[model samples]
Target: MSAFLSARRLALLATRCPRRTLSTTPRWSADPWPLPHTAQHLSNTQTPSDIPPPTPIPRPGESEETLRARLVYQSRKRGTLESDLLLSTFARDHLGKMDETELKEYDKLLDEPDWDIYYWATEGRSPPERWAKSSVLEKLTIHAKNEGKVVRRMPPL
Candidate 1:
């Protein structure tokens, strides 16, 4: 009976332990994800030059209209609705006063995954390396948290 129990324990241990080393193979190739039809349509609708450049500061002689338009578009269209409202409201409040450097950093933050930004903004996760820069992101994160404070909906109609 003791030998049988020992064998059962060994079998349990074997089942729980990892059998092989994790694979090092990359899941995705170097190519960017294929654009869906909507994304493709949006891209085709605007020329590369017509799109605002992603640098923190606008290029020398770049127009304010271009910067404003880009900021509005980026802030409003985050992949999820929650991020969209949070970012857009923050942008509307602060983008006008942000210096060229702040604008650039905000642009970089926009490049990160929406989920990461949402997590950081809500204080659900620490800011990762990509979010380390940019006072703008810091301020935006605070704003996102504040958005959680406001009453979300009327209790009854």
Candidate 2:
């Protein structure tokens, strides 16, 4: 009698529960939900690229303290990881001691592409004529060499 009751209960539960079917569609469909008209237009028009914008020239009468802070931030936030570590560490070690002229040169250096700067710093590629004579670049290359010291991480601000 107990076995019969158990069978009947199983039948009832099976009938009451709905069967689930696997979806034929992919989990990530190519079809995205509709966007607003303006957004759709912008999305279609804009293509992503790696180029960074030109760094702005220093404002007239900008204070040295403010310039140093800005350079530190830019150095720390360079888009590529290699450049970020190298530049941030270099800035921490050098920026405070740099005068207004040197700071301006460093700011211009920041405007160059990350790979170019990284290669130049590491001595993997020769810098262009403009940078070849720059004292700032010389200092950066010296810092990047790391010599006997290993630079495993970025220095704190």
Candidate 3:
């Protein structure tokens, strides 16, 4: 059946990229501007570069939101989800704190489901206040841990 062949092809594609592909996320650098801004402003510029800039992908559907929001409703407010608690503990307990790039990445995740969250979580930075209530932060932590990016931290003496 066509469905069976489609499923097989999907499996093959998943295997091709062992890690979640954040192809647009190069190592954060001071040199180049962030792609979201560039992509939005591209049409106004006089000289478009030879290589097209990355475009900001829109959320897939009504389901769009943070992993936390996807999993649980904040209005229920039975305190933070267990997953969020765990993520906070890890960042507060160790990871030596997040740098500017990591913080920006975390903030961006709250505003949007940009792939930047994966890098921020794996890099061990906490999302800032504007995004503190988001499910995207939860999803970022979950994915980073599930992908084997976790590290145990010793309590500060």
C-alpha displacement of 139 in model 3, angstroms?
Answer: 12
In model 3, what lDDT does residue 2 have?
100
Q: How does residue 118 of candidate 1 score in lDDT?
A: 68
Instruction: Tell me the tens digit of each residue's lDDT in model 1 across 8-83.
Output: 9999998999577777887664325433234443343232334443355436676676776687788788777667
2 or 3, greater by lDDT? 2
Predicted structure 3: lDDT: 0.43
Model 1: pairs clashing at backbone N, Cα or C within 3 Å: 56-104
* Rank by lDDT (best first): 2, 1, 3
Off by over 4 Å in 3: 1-80, 93-95, 112-157
| Model 1: ten consecutive residues of lowest lDDT | 40-49
Worst 10 residues of 2 by lDDT: 33-42
Q: Which pairs clash inside model 3?
A: 66-135, 66-136, 67-135, 68-135, 69-135
Q: State the lDDT of candidate 3 residue by residue for 73-130, as single tens digits.
A: 2112223233244444444432234443444344344343222343345533444455
